[model samples]
Target: MYGKKYLFFISFCILIIVASGCTIGESPAEKMYEHLEQTVSLESGFAEVQEPLIEAEQKEQELFNEMLGLSMKEIDKIKKLADEAIGLADSRGELITKEKESIDSAYEEFKSVNGLVDEIDEDTLKKKANELVETMEKRYKSYDDLHNVYMEALNMDRELYEMMKKEDLAIEDLKSRTEKLNKKYEEVLKSQDAFNNLTDQYNEKKKAFYKEAGFSTTDKKEAS
Candidate 1:
């Protein structure tokens, strides 16, 4: 009877060890998913901040159009509009700078997941996670490109306004500067489009990764 009791005690100890192993905190995959979700949440304000930037740009464009219709003889009017335009450009620049900072923060947060990716046990999941990281990095790079081009366009715009304030501004100089500014804007548009496309692609890839990894898709934020 004592031998049988000893055997039962050994089995009970083995069962406790197995259960403790199972209950020891979140799995590696779960930890990585939670980290990724936190990184995504950091970008939640991105779209919200963009609205004010758009409004500021629109105001600047209206001021530019109004200034274009004024004659050189209206020097005071031209200077006033030019000052207003310069101020608007400065404000727009501030908004863009803030937006860039937000993206930079998100990028840094996303990059922290590299160690978590390494901890993932499943080969396929690890590969998918790495791919998600690559796409997100590309998306951030694309935004950086767009931000540079847009800031260049804003600077050109400020230069054009400063030229307008000059009483002796040459018609040819104005025309050339305006043309160059338009071209710069065209480049900005192209960069914006590229950034947008990469963002969409990254979102899709992230959604797919979440689904494949068996993460909950019910959270609308994660669904994005």
Candidate 2:
């Protein structure tokens, strides 16, 4: 069974406020930050959707373990567990789709900031903004890769469950499938690591960009 990897949500505490004598006009950096905030806001449901999925996967793992000890005479119990596992896999698929849609929406919202980047007047700030955009793009791509690999592993898990329901299932066949599932999970872990690394990089670059743009930021933990 695959273990759950918790994804870090990107967040910041940049203070956006108008000074007492300042005009109502918003700077380009402020506008860009607004769009970025909207992008991050779209991902607020990520944990809500992900938790149930993880729980479902854990339940399926328990089912797999239970099925292992059943004899041919207990085939009815085996089929019942297999059916439950299949249903869990289907539910997981739906949750994953929702997860993908959430990220896709965030990516679309983030894309709006690319145009705003050019409006930044300060050369150094503009350069940093560009770097931030590029890193975010890469982070989004890494997540997509992670999603694909995870879905592949999910399908493999489902196939293994289906095999379990078969009466004449060969031990060698089950062994082979289990090996493949393990390898697929290894790939999933690798992809997950890549996504997390990119996310960390993006967060650091984003903080630097905010600082260079004169946005007063405090770490969220500090504020708390």
Candidate 3:
């Protein structure tokens, strides 16, 4: 009877060992790092697409300044530069659409991650996570708002330029339209400044998070 009982107990232990395998859950810091990595990657991609638009605008401005002192013979170069800038904007539509979708999806994941992150043993780290999430939400929303207004202004400016070229209008009429376009541009600039400031704050918070996790902050640059 004793022999049979001992054999039965050993079989039970073997079955239990076979049924339960070793498993490891990710630490809170690891989870946050993954989220940060994805967010930064998406932002970097968007910024790469956006860089050409910015450079084109700068080149256009330089051409405009040079054209001011030159004769009408130089107007062709200015027009070419302007067209290039507009083309840059047009070509980025698909990229921007994809980036918007990606960022939005990431933002949703960030929200879900927030709940899990509270389990972190460190109270300060949890608080920082909450702050970072809130800042990111605001930053993305402001960025979207600023981009919409900037595109609207760009389209209107182009339309006004075409109207001036294709049809003769009174000085007063053109002036009124120009003033309106200037106002729209001003609005876009204001939005951009706001967006930039928010982005800076986000970068600072991100650096703080990395520091808290004992990760290197030097490799993380601010995404524009």
Best by lDDT: 2
TM-score each candidate: 0.83, 0.87, 0.69
Error of 2 at 222 (Å): 12
lDDT measured at residue 150 in model 3 versus the true structure, 0 to 100: 66
What does candidate 3's lDDT look like per residue over 1-224, in tens digits? 00000000000000000111222238786677776666555444454545554554555445334433444455566456546544644544444565566657666656666766677889888777777778878987986887687667657646644443322345566567667866777787778777777777877776676567666544344444
What lDDT tens digits, residue by residue, belong to model 2 across residues 71-149?
A: 8679889999999989998998888888888889989999999898989889999999999999999989988998898
lDDT of each: 0.68, 0.75, 0.56
Candidate achieving the largest TM-score? 2
Model 1 scores what on Cα lDDT? 0.68
Candidate 1's TM-score: 0.83
What CA RMSD would you report for each candidate? 19.9, 4.6, 21.1
Superposed Cα deviation of residue 182, candidate 3 (Å): 1.4
In candidate 2, the residue pairs with backbone N, CA or C atoms under 3 Å apart (3 or more residues apart, or in different chains) clash, namely none
| Residue-wise C-alpha lDDT for candidate 1, range 123-163, written one tens digit per residue | 88888888878888897898788888888888888898899
Model 1 clashing residue pairs (backbone): none
